[model samples]
Target: MGRGRQKAKATKQARDIKYYSPNTDYSALQRELKGPEGRATSHFANDPVEPDYSAYVDKYADDLQEDDGEVDTRRIG
Candidate 1:
């Protein structure tokens, strides 16, 4: 088909889909929304526990403090 005909066909299909509303099955929707049975709600239920990094942060707190609060960005090779 020509470009104009193809574009017209696409526009008609888009309009039809935009105004179309099929019959909804509420029970099926509810079941689908509620998700599968006997499954844990948390997806991260099997994730490994993370170790606390507060100790490292506390150790480097004084070393990380700025003296003049200004960054020197001049290139140093």
Candidate 2:
């Protein structure tokens, strides 16, 4: 057998790319209701709680509100 340059075989070609329409309806989602100062007032206004950090917040209120002024501080530890 003699060594020869093998021609590359052409594979299946892909058709036109399909794309989804951009989400333009911002009001479609249940947005967070803002208070008079434009801040979230209700607890449910924020993202849904998975493990529920409220209990942890209550458990460590003293540590959480330790002059830092930040509401969420469970990650400090």
Candidate 3:
């Protein structure tokens, strides 16, 4: 097909898909959203997410670190 015909066909197909609506089962959706009755709402209570990093932060604060602040870069050899 020519470029114009191919483009028109693609445009029509895209418009059909954009306006398409399929039958929705809302009750099934509600059940899926509710989930199982016995399942925990969150797994955080049983697991240690992040370990104590404050100690490491304080300990490493003494180490010599590079300057993160802005510096004048205008000087050129």
Q: Pick the candidate with the highest lDDT.
A: 1
- How do these models rank on lDDT, best leading? 1, 3, 2
Local distance difference test values of all predictions, in order: 0.88, 0.51, 0.82
The clash tally of candidate 3 reads 0
Residue pairs in collision within model 2? none
Worst 10 residues of 2 by lDDT: 7-16
lDDT of 3 by residue, 27-51 (tens): 9999998888898675557766778
lDDT for each residue of candidate 1 in 1-77, tens digit (9 for 90 to 100): 46999899999999999999999999999999888999867677578989998889988888778556777789999
Tens-digit lDDT track for model 2 on 1-77?
A: 33332322211122222344566756644352333455546556466657757768778888757767656647764
Q: How many clashes (backbone N, Cα, C below 3 Å) per candidate?
A: 0, 0, 0
Q: Give the TM-score of candidate 2.
A: 0.25
Q: Global lDDT for candidate 1? A: 0.88
Off by over 4 Å in 1: 1-18, 44-51, 58-77
Off by over 4 Å in 3: 40-77
Quantify how close model 1 is to the true structure by its C-alpha RMSD in Å.
Answer: 6.7
lDDT value, candidate 2, whole model: 0.51
Give every collision pair in model 1: none
> Candidate 1's error at 50, in angstroms?
8.5
